[model samples]
Target: MASPAIHIPHGPARSAHLLQRTTAEWRERGEDLLLFAYGSLIWRPEFEYAEALPARVLGYHRALRMRSSVNRGSTHQPGLVLALLPGGSCRGLVYRVPRAIGEEALPQLWAREMPNGVYDPRWLHCDTPSGRLRALAFTLSRRSPNWTGPLHEPELLHIFRHAEGRYGTTLDYLLRTVQGLREHGIRDMELERQAHLAARHGLCAPP
Candidate 1:
């Protein structure tokens, strides 16, 4: 069964405050900090973690509908990156960071994901093979200027063709995500379909 939709309210200081609050809470409890990852974090966590396991978060699903002009695209032509939007569920990986390392990781994570303070850092309950646990997950705020609710085919095609940023091209991001999911035994049909579309149109190589 599918999960219900969620409405996440955020303020100007939400991202910063939430990041600090969560880290402090974890430190106070003296437990491992868990992070729910459904995108690049699944493949390139770029942080040290004590453990990682297959996990699923309800009330949200992954979609490459978030506008990115930095890591995966540019100002002239934007690219799409994954965002955990309301509805359904998402299957990915949950990383467990030790208390000592989490302090160092939190700031770096905040810088990477909250460059514009667009994402809402939420504590979500994730179901894992081991058990259910609460983890920090970055979620999308539909009201954010960076949110690309939807895009026309032509606009998307243009992005796939010309969107390249400091990290890499939008096409590369899509293909890599598709590959990452497969590598983890997690299949996202929609992402796979998009990859095929990009390849068919010569926007990228075959997935």
Candidate 2:
């Protein structure tokens, strides 16, 4: 089946501008930085890191609640992506970036993550097996236009079944995230359940 055409947003320029301003502010502090990867970053960080460790973030849960209008779905038939929803905890990876390379890395990270400024990147406390740390995390601001709160099963399933975009199908993103989490010894019950349903119903797209 043919997917609907999508209008890619042009907010990446704004994101780049914000990155310059924000990273400069961060640089003023003169400290090492850490990034918490809960979704795609768990597998495709696309950046250099000095070290990585298993980490748990409190007070936020990973939800398949972001609307992807370009990468994983079209504007006409938007798909669901993972977002850091409030009220629970998430187990993921924390990447430590050395201060020497912070400038080069932060802008690149922002360009990838804040393309449309749908996320609010903030520093949140993390509990790692090694120790405690405050790490930068891209979280969904409920007020963002891309936030999809509390979708019904039928709608979500439909998205998983058909939505496709630049990256791939929605189902592929879901499956990959599940695989990435498992490799890190973390099993997200909600994602696992949804994945089971997807597999059982043959929601995956053809290669």
Candidate 3:
């Protein structure tokens, strides 16, 4: 399987443009919410938001920090998972919510995704094109064994390849994350290597 061509809706310049627009809207509306996306949420279309922007976080890394016990062969299912590992930097998208509606909107967002103990939401400082901002993001549960032990890329990919959810399969998640990384002008050599291995070994979904 060949690696998918990552589609960036607009060029890197547009990222700054979007940031300005989002910041202006937030200021005008007095919003107090920020969303940091590190996984499928970064590119999944169904999980759409009113204002989306390109953002980054320093001093943190992206990994398969979470695990799902509920397997989805090709559909959405409910259950819990584990949050594993730490160390490294992760790059993804961030969203801002208006202060007046943030509280009301966050619950809906949480309900849609974090129905069970599958995800642990936390506040992390994110670096954006505009500047630094605190955003809400989800990480895997710390209770799982994978959280404390060494993880192999192939194994994680295998797990994600079979996992399914309301939006799509785990392979879809991996593809979208790779695309999002390219869109944000972020690069991880490890991720690139893992992706290549997946492609070389025919680990991705069928085209």
TM-score of each: 0.89, 0.87, 0.64
Put down candidate 1 lDDT per residue, 12-110, tens digits, no spaces: 365566666666766776788899999999888999998899999989999989988777887788787899998899999999998789889988988
Best by lDDT: 1
How many pairs of residues collide in model 2? 0
Model 1 worst lDDT run, 10 consecutive residues: 1-10
The alpha-carbon deviation from the true structure for residue 35 of candidate 3, after best TM-score superposition, in angstroms, is 0.7
- Candidates' lDDT values, in order? 0.83, 0.79, 0.54
lDDT of 3 by residue, 1-207 (tens): 111222223233433443334445445545577788766566653443567777766655676444443332322422122231244566677876666666566556654545433444456677777788777665543453325245576565665556675555555555666766777676756556656666766776432
Instruction: Write out the backbone clash pairs for model 2.
Output: none
Best by TM-score: 1
The ten-residue window of minimal lDDT in model 3 covers 1-10
Name the lDDT value of residue 67 in candidate 2.
93
Clash tally, candidates in order? 0, 0, 13
